[model samples]
Target chain A: MAVSVLTQKKNMPAGNPVERLLAATADDMARVNSLILSRAESHVDMVPELARYLIDSGGKRLRPMLTVAAAQLFGGGAGNAVNFAAAVEFMHNATLLHDDVVDESDMRRGKPAARMVWGNKASILVGDFLLGQAFMMMVETGDIGSLGVLSAASAVMAEGEVFQLAKTGDLATTEADYAEVIRAKTAVLFEAACEVGAMSGGADAAGRAALARYGLELGNAFQLVDDALDYGGQSGALGKNVGDDLREGKMTLPVILALAAGNEAEKAIIASALGKADASDLEVSQVVAIFNRHDTLNRTLEKADAHARTAVEALGILPESEMKTILADVVMHSVRRAS
Target chain B: MAVSVLTQKKNMPAGNPVERLLAATADDMARVNSLILSRAESHVDMVPELARYLIDSGGKRLRPMLTVAAAQLFGGGAGNAVNFAAAVEFMHNATLLHDDVVDESDMRRGKPAARMVWGNKASILVGDFLLGQAFMMMVETGDIGSLGVLSAASAVMAEGEVFQLAKTGDLATTEADYAEVIRAKTAVLFEAACEVGAMSGGADAAGRAALARYGLELGNAFQLVDDALDYGGQSGALGKNVGDDLREGKMTLPVILALAAGNEAEKAIIASALGKADASDLEVSQVVAIFNRHDTLNRTLEKADAHARTAVEALGILPESEMKTILADVVMHSVRRAS
Candidate 1:
């Protein structure tokens, strides 16, 4: 089962760490996909219609892949990882459906948001439906321990959201606040996914803690890159327009950093554009110019690189397997996107 | 424990079964209430704000009370009925939050709906938060069987809402369809409440089955009476405006029965008013007149009476106790409200 370090290095490509993870876990991924589709089915047509719309939408399903991959690495009979993987995917999608409604977002993943087609009410109810299905999947595994982990993550995620909503446009929102927000809203789920994956895979306490830390740091790196991309990356790459975070008054790291460092006039331009919802592209460019002058976007990416390094470091405690190597590479690739 | 039938009858008052049941489970109900309020707390202020708004809005807490009463009826140890009871209340309040948003309701329990005060987005997110908290409470109980039952009920309830939405204005919605809707939307939760209560109370299989049947039939009767009251009883007694269901285009049994028996003109009146969201009082009375012509209100009450009788019959298997008598009387009172 041991591969030479040279072979491992050659097999790890700079591009498509996510794709590599998915391929490594492809067999389990197929089972997870089938479980997801079957559970999304309901006697109510709209339940399936709206659910399938979001589930079938083209996305990497990176979260579930992480789950399956983490389980594969530990190799503990793959006990209910399929169910847990599907549960993780549903949880992630449920948040997306709710997020679009909360942000009044019109587009997701190069397609119209589920809220846009079915309206907000349906989106909300269907999001609840998906969440219910997620719990059902967790229960079916009969792993009460994993159920506790996932359920706690769900609450933390909601609190993170409400916290973000409260701080949406606050100019004085600090870096520490941003860290708390991302930790709860994004990284906690990732940590739970990996931790539960390890639990089902028969990992010892140290192995579980290592994966948890890996997922958390990787999630932080992922979101930081996403925030920087909102200001500097292509809309095609982002799956939305550039500067959406600014338009929505999201106090992302780049904005928080730029605001803290900007002169009086630069601060004025950002304050005017942020949270406007209809802030023109010209206004976005002005904000971007300010971000450039302050070097906040690159600084945000720099922070992402630091976290990605920590994420890779987290994986060092685990035994060297191809899955572990791919997972570490995936963390690096996420931050490399911004670079 | 072996009280005579006559003694049971003498102790049970026909006038206030729900109140009697509440009194019977007062201590457990108090713990459930405290747990509910404590669990509703969050670092995110909006969550507690919106959650408390709905949780404290004068709900009867009948579902949670049933959980407590069912648990207390058996002399089994009260393992975690407090947690299950609070979980049931949270689940009920969660539905109310989402229901207000879906129904576009401006008022609930004689006050402005949460959505009306805080907007639909907050209502939806807070509802999700409460559901998360509900599952967390369930996991704390460490009862996987009961968790499966409640989680299945959650999914079925969401399906019920979506099913009800699908049939909102469809004239072809049959009596069978109406039964399915109510069973999923309302009765399933009741069944789960009693079943889990029995589980927590350390009931044997037969005892659990009996309570489950009791709750299902009582919930059916409760919903049927509420439907009849929408057309025939006082709006003050019902909490919302009379004919609110008709305005929302809910195809309750009374409306379905009237439509089945009425003339084409009557059919037209019912159809036009079904989903208008602003159907006038005169139009409501006209529909009521059609219902009277067919004696549909009386017929709906008859259906409720039949369900209530079944609910009482379900309790016959249990040992004669004050709690059992009060539970039976509560079912009778629910139907008596329509009478």
Candidate 2:
């Protein structure tokens, strides 16, 4: 009863970091949203229709928010930040469209995935369309330095996704491999989003580097929390089913830790369910029980908290401001979501 | 027998324009090849493995040659031409990968598609990796104007693909739609390749526009020939089955013209075969017989020839050089391939 009460209280946040960040960046974000909508448009009907489905789908748009917020933190009031923010969101949404196809995902943002509604072909092409528009927006900014950051990040993100695909369902996948995957597939975009934002905002060298580090750490923490939530959090909150990563044979931290700790019987049970597309809810529950027995979820959350702390600390170099404080809180709240 | 003799003579060119162009730009092309190979590489083994399989699979390497040749015509000797050339090739290969996935193509360049070898997921990711690398190379050149040209072309190309997909099997698809499709899917890249090459080569405004129109017309000719060859050329030469466009339900000029002219019985036969993945060789031949009755293949090639003439005329503004002669001959030879 005491533990349950503690969990309930922890889940109830006194202040919502995302809401605060959104409020703080609302003015800039409106421009970002408009840009995202316009850039996603195409003369091809399917291009705009499919793109709008994913773009207008209730994504948190956190990556672009980070871009805008980072720009604001450096006193950026120009048009470049808006462009960069829109481009970052396009990159994120493009990846989402492709990721859904790669993962054979059925739902995204609490709705049927674009692939499901439009088929894998549409998903793949629209993803490419969005990616092209993203670069177009970046080019419109006329900032080659920031474009370089985003382009390199795009390559690394694809590599991370490929590497993760190769390692999928391999029980021997190491923590190092997982780290590389998250950094490439998830964190690098966050890093680029912030770095480019800072660049657009006219941040000095040190300021830019600080924001990059902050973004990288936050991305790492964010992905770690996501991995844990896929097994521990509610489906309603996640906009996806629990144990999806497990079913997909994703060698996430919780599963890696559980595999390392569990006995032969437990390992066999987990392996049977891993990568089984039709993995039953009962099987998922059984796996979660094993994860609980090993305390892997909590251990994963601990790792996430460490990353979140580092992310907050990375911003220490920046001059204190309301935006900076909100940014730090966003990192903390990212990890706390796993509770 | 006379028609067959004429076809054989037309097919066997006394001097291959592609070979001539290849020889003309050998040094630049060597750099382009090296850049393509190096840029396609990644720490992720699968990235290079899949990319190289397609890149090295004996594509005529025509687009990059166009880039190189366009640059050479301007009397420019600089590294940016090489970069843009390689980048154009990367963009082309990336599209090939995604196109195979979208089209569910079994063979490319007389070999199994990357999607067939590594699965659709790998093809999509590696294609993305190549696109990212392409942009990175463009950024490295620090030529934002050319980058803008290529990036906008990328968006338009994607739109072209999506439009083609939507109109597949619609039967109501028009000549204008076919024109739009081929321009978007094929010609725009050629336009960008040449335009960017001219820009990189320090061409004057008129020179650049002329080269752009040249590439655009050449691309139209190239794709028109490709459509005809899909029905009328040898598989060995086309590197794909006869009637693949029909099987894919692609409303190319050949098919659209035939459909518009065919009686109801002929239309029924074509409709039965259109979009049928398992469409037999016998069915393909039947469709080809109908195509011959209407002489649609020759008409498509005639259209291609017109575009080829326009392409050559577009280059009339430039000073005569060995490269310009070879470029104009390349367009003529592209049309002749379907004879």
Candidate 3:
């Protein structure tokens, strides 16, 4: 299995390599955190209440950390990186809030989703508020190139979500469709975050392009690992309800692979469980058993490893530095989460 | 009633003044229309489907027209005004989609609300897509000042909606509180629309300030009339289900005024209907009876008249032209909708 292979090859600190990247960007990240908190404020009570509920909730701030780390890699100081990072975080949280409403998800980051506490209407409006604040932060930077990148990402992410919604419950969904879904919904933002960070860091055309490729490949690997984790990882480690993707009928890579490889009887088992909110634990285990028989989860992990390798390769254009090493490790750590 | 006063004064052509404003800015507005439709395109089927449902609906493009007209006022040629106008329209429609979800509205522009057709999830996501596109359009203009104005308006609009939600069914809501709600929820966007249009048109500091004031006052007047109409005007004319505000328990000015002046017996009747989804026509008429007895609807029109006059006065700084005169007429037309 790819997980066993991944585990045997890795020898690093117990903590996530992502954590190391965070430490390298700690000071800039602190400023980003402060700006995030301060900008969430509003005279209208619910704006801050709902915003803080999501922002202060324990997200690793990985996307924004990537933003800051990417900037630092190019020797960018605490210039527009702080604002861009904060804006990226806001965009991520905003999507989370809306996605919860769309998915009817009750749990997020091991806590009740904002929609659960505040109602769908509040969640939706506050999400809009966060996005507005995000754009406001970008505008204040007067960096038109960064603004375009982020805004385009925002549009693509929405399209990705809609496409996923359309494909839900469809067993015939192709890997190409799955790839497009992840690319638009997940990888595009990562690409934009790193690209904008590069732009703010005074990256030339080549450096900026390299960072964008790095972010996209890393994002693809991260999503693949996450999809596999939904089937195999601990719920506590994942910080979400187990079998959520299966329950929601998401056409992730592992499920698609399993479906493609399975016999008729095995397909029937997954069909019954897919999109069933009340699908029993026994049903999920049944599906997992089938996945194991086909080695689909490992195959998914193998694909993730391929993307992660490409992500590391993307960093070759940049001069070697401690930050670059950490970034590369972060890519590996994302895929290793399933290990 | 203020309607009588408005109709008697200096009658312009029988044509709708909004149509006149449209004619004055036809070229730029046509461009804005094309940009709006083009930007709504996405590979995701639902994105364009829901977006077109709202954008192609029969509602007059008043906000974007204000943007184009403001540009024309400064003799602006083909410039960023087209992009800003399209951006303003997208922002307006984005709010409409979300508002339908928040208000549980089934009707908009004399048709089923997008939420009703595509479900609330699609509506929310597509609304988000539009806002993203709006920001992209603004970024493409490379006008950071205009971008800041539009984004700030977006934040205020969300805050306003939340404020209104909090005040829903609040019996003791004050006139000032009601004013604040509309100012944030409605007027700020109008102000931003004209302000950005003026900025794109290369208006001087005084000219920009004047357009901002004009837009703010016009928006205030327009909303006041609309709120009053919720109690008195035809649903067909409004392109909304009559009594929608009452059904949603929106703390509109007429309702607030009636509540303040209402005796306990009348207050009881209003409360019974406020926020009641099943509130019958009989109950609505009962609330209308209370409003008419207090002259509250007339009082709302009078307030609107005051704002409309200020709107015209705000335009006094501009050199008189056919466009300027038509713009002033448009202000009057908005208030006189009740007549």
Fnat by candidate, in order:
0.62, 0.78, 0.72
Per residue, candidate 3 scores C-alpha lDDT tens digits across A1-339 of: 434324544555566787788788899998999999999998888889989988888999999998988888898786999999999999999999999999999988878888899899999999988999999999899998899999999988988988998899999999999999999989999999999888888889999999999999999988988888988742213233668899999988878988999999999999999999888777888888888888888888888888888888898888978888888888878887777
What proportion of true contacts does candidate 1 retain?
0.62
Q: How do all the candidates rank in terms of lDDT, highest first?
A: 3, 2, 1
Over A25-127, each residue of candidate 2 has an lDDT whose tens digit, in order, gives: 8999998998888887777889889999888888899999999888888897846989988988988988999999999999898899999888999899889
Write model 2 residue lDDT over B1-339, tens digit each, in one string.
113212333444357889988888999999899889899888889999999999999899999888888888898884798999998998999999999999999989888888888999999999899899999999999999999999999888988999999999989999999999999999999999999888878899999999999999999988988888888652213234877888899988877888999999999999999999889988888888888788787778778877877888898888877788788778877876776
In terms of docking quality, model 1 is medium
Q: What would the per-residue lDDT of candidate 3 be over residues B64-104, giving only the tens digit for each residue?
A: 99988888889888599899989989999999999999998
Q: Write the per-residue lDDT of candidate 1 for residues B1-339, one digit (tens) a residue.
A: 022222334555555777787777888888888899999999888889989988888889999988988888887655588899898888888898888888888989999999888887778778888888999999999999999999999988888887888888889999999999999889999999998998888889999999999899988888888888887652223234888899999999989998999989999989989888888888888888888888888778778777877878888888888888788878867776655
Off by over 4 Å in 3: A2-15, A234-240, B2-11, B233-240
Number of the top TM-score candidate: 3
All DockQ scores: 0.67, 0.80, 0.81
Docking class of 3: high
Clashing pairs in 1: none
